[model samples]
Target: MARPDSQLLPLGDFKPSDEWQTHVNAIFYGIKGPEIHHHFQTYVSRDYRLAHALADTFLEEVRKQRLADDTITIQEWGVGNGNLAARFLSRLKSVDAAVYSHIHYTLCDYSEEILNGVRVNPNLQEHEGRYFLKQVNAETQDDFEPHSVHKIISNEIWDDLATSVLLQNNGMLYEEFLQPLLQRNIPNVPWESFVEQFAGKDLDALKKNPPFLEQIVWERSFQRIDISDWPYGTFILKHLDRLADEIPIPINTGAFQTLERAKQLLAENNLGYTSFDYGMLSDHELNLPGRPYYKLYGGQYTSMVNFPLIAEVGKAIGFADVQLEHQHDFVGRNLSENVLSALELVQVHPRISRMEPWDADLLMLQTLQALNASYRSPYKGQMDYPPMPGTPKKQRKQITELARNLSATGVPDTVAYITESEVAESTGRLKKLGYGERDLKNAFDRSTQPIAFGHMTLR
Candidate 1:
């Protein structure tokens, strides 16, 4: 139920000044500039609570294993800003001081520039002796030793871990609506012929401009691949070239071959890894088809990258104890309910609680009109008068008349008229929807929340 204000700028308005870009670079690299680090905390801390919670849960499990005294080596993949690592360590320290006494943490990211920035955080100085930061891509697993780390943690990192272009051409509706476009893209090719050529291989022909390609190569799909066997981070790129020409749709043989190669590479080691992000499940569990949570800011889709599938690949590679722990059902429900409740409060209309049939139409309309006028400009384009240049007198008069009519409708009091009932029915409705009075109070409190580094801090 964390309600962090969105840090997104309006679409098309993102022009980063040189100074700001430098600041962003510093933060992404993990250099500790207070200004940049503060902004990172403001934006990322909202979603990173999951990582913190997961770390806490993992630590609890480790304790049950009676390894508190033994060095707990944690490797965080894609540690942008190192915020998750910091938070996890902080929580661990708070929960079990003994565990913190003998822990080693390795933070890794792809960008050396960002990693340099990450090393500057004053907070990290406390753990300087025990912590290590690396400029390495998870796909390469470059200098990391096999089976060295006890636990691997990542948050929203798997979706971009390894890239692939996903061609979604299934479902009856999709075929009906989009198949024609797909057909048009192929030059006089039969559906079967097309499927045979591209089914599992990289669509090199479509690289110039894949008609249905949603994102660029770097920004394409990401699915977690198990490297528990071959090496901790070895990844072989699997090019999914597909064609759709004949019955049973000819899938490119190269795609499966590439997958097999990846499996072989991952079969060389034993590793324990866990990734958490919003994703859809392929299995039929409670009829919930998994879906990616697209970042509107980045215009990218991030999926869960099915750990079970990755585990199967691991098994194929000769790794054992590949457990796919999906804590989604428990956490997703709470997060979804919190988000829905906030949205409901924003859209709730005051007039929906009318007991009488007559109260639904005329009075409600007038009330809505008045509220709309006050919120949206009643006189947008009207000429400015002498006293109030931009104000529209006609619209103002209409609003006044509406107000008078509402008053004449025998509403008891102005406060009662607006709120609709004692304790406010909207508040009651919000509570029922899982938003407590505390949540409402917090929303109001955000307006007064102090600004630090151009971001609001609730506390």
Candidate 2:
């Protein structure tokens, strides 16, 4: 977890652990078989206002347009589980009757399994012919007709798209090329069946010219990223000649490509689109502490969007208005104030918390984040629990004594040396101390302040 400039250990110092991400994620995401959504659920927010926000904005555009035959075509890109589509369609029906009646709402996804869920959904089923299911790849959007759709929207999807891991060293950029290491001559070989899909291609050689995965021109290895190729090349060099510092960036080329494709697919008459993804608004936050800009979730790769680039690209593509804002601000402006106030009240009050399962999960995550900041390594008491302000003193004393025992008896070495069994034992002790399931989880959970949601619109 050291900074980019920490040290150097010649080339090919250490090969990375076997992982499936980026374009390789296609293997796991039902491109071969079994849709990814069947196992991995990303649509945790069903009844939330952000879902309504996207639908509401789409409706706004629908209302603004001059209708010819009193109809409009709206499509959603990368429709995973179709919860958002069902939710949005239901919300649209309740909000605007005029737009909902003449709407051709299409759910676009690459996986037939995913689109099947959309077809069976009770909420979407109510819409009937108005709702069409289209199996299309977001990368090429091959099935879609340009200037045929009125509005396009995606939620938490751009990150799931193909991305390029990059690095900056000595004022130049390089792409991180990943080579999947497969076990050879081993019992119950991992990915044996999947690797068999590629005819006449060695696993090692596939790293350079992958059939499914993407690899840039020049590759350099450091930590998990390999950065050697610079797409900008002489262009970037000329620009850097007038600049001060060369910022290290993990560019999401796939997202940029998607945006460019969206521009083509959108109608020429004030085509409107909204993309809501968790990303960084500035380069300064790229390498900051407590910032997980890039993360691996459920074996799929996701990276923080360089939102400014989206806006600039949108402007270049003749978008009359391109705006980027935090999700909190966008949601606040569109949603009722009472909803946010109620959430804040619940956070401050000790009474009943009406948060859903996802909210509770968020709370525990916040607590653990705070705990990380409070205590350093070698302290075995570094466990996740409820905040002290909310818990009673008796329970607090029990936790303190448990911490003392862990610090004394547990590994006297660093955090890395701490065993999984030791941590599990500490968790068991917390349960015995009479802390409820939710309370135990709340100990270190701080508010989601550091976690900022990025919202961008192209119109």
Candidate 3:
């Protein structure tokens, strides 16, 4: 808990946003460790479908390319809870034992805390001999030999890496900078003492105390800056020249570094690098006014992945082919059907837009109930949907009943996707909830957003 509100004290001088982002994330992941999942959600955090889809795609690629080597090397960076790796291996083994026999999977993360935590997950235990864990900071890790890894995949990691925000006014480009300040009072500890502990890297001592990172407040300022010396500066500048002025554009510099590293690490007969993240997919969306460039979750800075820039970076780094599309589209390609996220399907309901928050929650649960019939997930145990605060006692009880009866096999939460056939199976139940067949048909259609889930693959 925070201490009595007090005057904010400057934690440090203003620094470039990317530098500050990297600094804060380094500290956040260092301390939060395994508990980081509580602050943010990733598609693979609880769902098995995405992992299975990726496994299928990789297997198809393996068959087509048919690498001569006896062993297949696949590395997943920024793995969360080891679920994706576990599910992927499970799918591979169940699908084809021969390919699974040659698979050598590696989990890479910057936090030893996270690595240690993933090491003990019961789900990963079944794939004991097939996987290894390595601590790697994406921005500057080079221990792996060039052309060694056959496949590299990451989910929701690029957003946490270093990104710089630029806004052009009257042809003058300005970069965002931020100064960190701490809350005046923090329980029993003095502010200065907190700073001393933070500077000394006494993470263990800090961990035993109240959350210090939560007390941070950002002070933003902008200044003209030079990027001539930065990596891919010329390429980034050329792209920025084509974009409109007065709109802040995020450049994921760290993502560019990761792409470069991926190019170096992937084998000549590789399946290549693929990452799933949330961000803008087109230049038109990036040029829109009032688009958010970054957000903070549990005091960790996360910037949008900037998919368009990433594509350019991938090509500039010598990847032969680069593809960017909606994440559901990527999953759909493997399933041979159109797909929609649970939230997207919920939004397509005819009466949803007119419903109140409580009513909307009810509708969502009903929708999930309808989808649950044939949407059985192979892996379960991550279902928890609490009713909204201020829900009436009767409605709360109704929600509880629905949640209790919700199948362990139900379509997973908002981020998980369901195929068209699954929606077809639920059509009768959905019609009672006022959804028409066309609504179900159009449920497969996804509209582009200023910001949305995106998948990028570089080959």
Candidate 4:
């Protein structure tokens, strides 16, 4: 049912989009809490490949810096569901108990609800006294002294940070501002109720009335302004001046601040800050016309992290060097194998996408069965693949059996990282599924796109 247009509720006066973007995202995460995973997946889920890879990379550095009786402090920003921390710590312990003993892990997030959810994780219970949780906003919080921490890490948090969209056209600059409107009326809920609740940061009220969130509508306008007074404004403008006109550029102001704060927290000889996220990697990519700069997921505003700009900011903040590369490359370097993401491997079966939905699911399970032989994960985590509602009894039974027999080490169906040797070992089964050695090798080919999933480090 549509409300009369006149009764629509408008949220907050129009200003820079990030101000409202950050506010709305806070409301989303605060209301949904850890249950936000149902809306999107992180690399930590399905398998522990990324966490293990990260742990392996950090292990070498930890070994080099392990002086007698010194505690190695590591902080993970945006610790969701605590899975990454659990797996990283577990891997570190399994491989080298001595180094793990010197570890003091801290999980930091802005939402108390998220921190509370992480506190009760059964995995964290096993590492009792080794880790603690801190409620700190990545953008502005400076809870630690300068050069106090050893290493800082975050995954997929940058895109959600406050970002403003800017457009350069005909020798002028403009900032995008958004006005969020309720697309329709909710039964017995007045516009005033929403305005009050949103302004008050009333998570309880917003959680109870979920429908209001589903109806959010954004109206956009651009205002020309001088950004000389804004934080890092001059640096951002200089970067933007090099890009093509009429293309919107995402200025990751929040991400820049995170780097600044990370510089302060990291020790002089620290391993420094490492972040894994998806975004633009080069100026050529940002200069392309009609490129998307931001997207909305589950009513939360998210922008690409703008890696090129972020790299420049990291260097400007006095980091010795900045390293930017694809996430697969980073994982591969640590594991000493040519790594390919699960999605990339699935692309080897060209006809899979053209098949019926259920047929595709069956084929996917079959593919996983083949890869399960050699893609064993040291971490034991459950991954289920129940068939669709209308699956035939025989096919359903097959899927059930495959899922049950899924190796405790089976490759994840979505984002699992697999090496070339692991794929080579599964050649017989892969051939049966119409994937040969050549196809498998080609899956690891690096993508040339400007914006893709990547990792970055500041040291």
Q: Put the candidates in lDDT order, highest first.
A: 3, 4, 2, 1
Candidate models: Cα lDDT each: 0.38, 0.52, 0.85, 0.81
Each candidate structure's TM-score, on Cα atoms with residue i matched to residue i, is: 0.44, 0.62, 0.91, 0.89
TM-score-sorted candidate list, best first: 3, 4, 2, 1
111-163: candidate 3 lDDT, tens digit per residue: 98888789889899899899999999987899799999999999999999989
lDDT string, candidate 1, 349-386, tens digits: 34345423333333333433333322221112211112
Better of 1 and 2 by lDDT: 2
Tell how far residue 375 is off in model 1, in angstroms.
29
Query: Model 4 over residues 222-329: C-alpha lDDT tens digits?
Result: 999788898777788889878888888898888988998998898876998999998888887888777778878777778987898898878888887899988887
Better of 1 and 4 by TM-score: 4
**What is the TM-score of candidate 3?**
0.91
lDDT score, candidate 1? 0.38
User: Better model by lDDT, 2 or 4?
Assistant: 4
Query: What is the number of backbone collisions in each predicted candidate, taken in the order shown?
Result: 41, 15, 0, 0
Model 2 poorest ten-residue lDDT run? 412-421
